[model samples]
Target: MLPQPSGPLRLAVGGLTSITDDFAFFTYNLCDYRRTGRSDEARYARVEEVIRELVRPGTPTVGAVQELPGDDWTSAAHGLGHLASATGLHCQAFTDGTRSAAAVPGGHDCLGLGLLWSAEVDPIADTLRYISGGPLWHALVMVDLNVGGHRISAASYHAPPKAGRDRRTAEAGLVATTLRSHAGDGGEIWLGADWNSPSSRTTDGLYYDPDPTEMVTSADRQRWGDDLPEIGYRTDRTPDMIMADAGFRDAAVEYGAPWAPTTGHGPNDRNGPRRIDRILYRPAAAAPGGVA
Candidate 1:
């Protein structure tokens, strides 16, 4: 179930067909510890501070948030509302990723995905849609927005974690197909996701080095059998490659040469540092629209 905005003020659509100035699009995985009796206020405050520091003042921003607290609609709404108020952003939609938890053996119990946008943009009526069709570990929630007057579709996705390379690649194909269908020929599309897999374009040699102790350990092989690869976890680039083949470009890669690691800084770091989180976009300039 998706949660409705409590009370968000929206602007009437009227502006140029394309944006001349810069805007911000950010993706974050707000590790779902709050559901396990952690303090929500402290976590929300820290997240708000990080967002404020990253997003420039007066810039229209859109955020794709993964791992909201709780699996139920009520808890998801509460978390979304709290974050929206804290960041002064409008709650667009929330999709419960744990709806099929009972069906998945040993799957996570509580996980949700959400989207938030600044007041400058208005959500296109009835454009919100959730992508499904495969064994997706988390929700791939998308919505069309009228940014000033330029329309674009954005999605928040989280690929399955741990020893699911085939599943991840399959899910990536589903995502790419869905985005291409929605965007059509000229529509712009933005996707922010914690892919849980290293990029195909990674120049970093550390990711390629075989380390047996990291993600796929002896215990993991014993449990899941010998089908798992030996080259550590998240080393497979097939998932990211699927996305690249669909015409999407990685934001971090386009911004510079060396990609910065987005995860493994926490105290519970297990897989070592890697740039698993990404913001990918399919420009409209590739088709009919002149804007990118």
Candidate 2:
């Protein structure tokens, strides 16, 4: 079971997982060392140069070139080291951005939850190697910390608008499968992504309605019902359905944070189109007084 984000217990945060999607905005920390990690003019710049040389365009591949899994693991480990070296954050890159590299370069975007205290990241190889089916580099990084703890997992995915019910269901299954691998007895697990799922359902299996006490504003509630009901590819299907099936509850639903939405379409469009990009955890038992 995953922990709930409440009472100063196990805290987890997440962001849209689509590393390269413009909609999934976040500075690419992997390549953009200066922007990604802490400050150190000389060190950060040098690390950035090394990454560019390793994966440079139209130049001799100076470093080792391996399969997607190998490359991803290597990159994440390296990135984590860089973060630690710069700011002592000890941040680790979980999902493999290589999935979007071919189509979307500079992909290492993470959910802007907060600094993840800890997590367990998993990677997909076969699917990631393919180009047609979106990136397979998804993960369930277990996080710990409080409000200041910027922690989150990534489920970066973008499918054709036509992929309605079936696709959303399949995507849900994938998230469930991933959670099953890392879930604990009482910790919370977060699945962050540009699920493309309209906020029709909550991660805990409840439908979003116009109850200000239970949900966001009437306009936000209407967005779930009318606009684009079918999230992902299938009709009446969405990413929430996936998390709900996995035994996880919605943080925004169970906890009251409707005012804080995750997926904003554009810069100016602060209150832009919405998606349940950040999925929270529902522990079987609530920590007494919120103590882990």
Which candidate has the highest lDDT of all? Answer: 1
lDDT of 1 by residue, 1-292 (tens): 0111122111111000111135667788777725546676775567676655555466667777777764565666677667777777887532352221111111244667677788876676656777432357666778877665677888888788764556888889989998888767677888888887666654344433122234445422212223335443324677888998988877655544343456555666555555567778888754344223
Give per-model CA RMSD.
Answer: 9.7, 13.1
Q: How close is candidate 1 to the true structure, as a TM-score?
A: 0.74
Range of the 10 consecutive residues with the lowest summed lDDT in candidate 2: 59-68
lDDT of 1 at 73: 58
TM-score of each: 0.74, 0.43
Candidate 2 lDDT over residue span 1-292, tens digit each: 2223342111112122211111111212122333333455774555434333222232111111111121243443444444434432223323344322211212223211112221222222222211123432223222332211222232223322322434556656665665445434444434433444454454445544222212333422323333354421122445566566667655456554543444342344323444435443444335422312
Runs of candidate 2 with Cα error greater than 4 angstroms are 1-71, 83-87, 92-115, 118-166, 184-188, 202-236, 265-271, 284-292
Candidate 2 global TM-score:
0.43
Model 1 spans > 4 angstroms off: 1-21, 93-108, 132-134, 202-234, 286-292
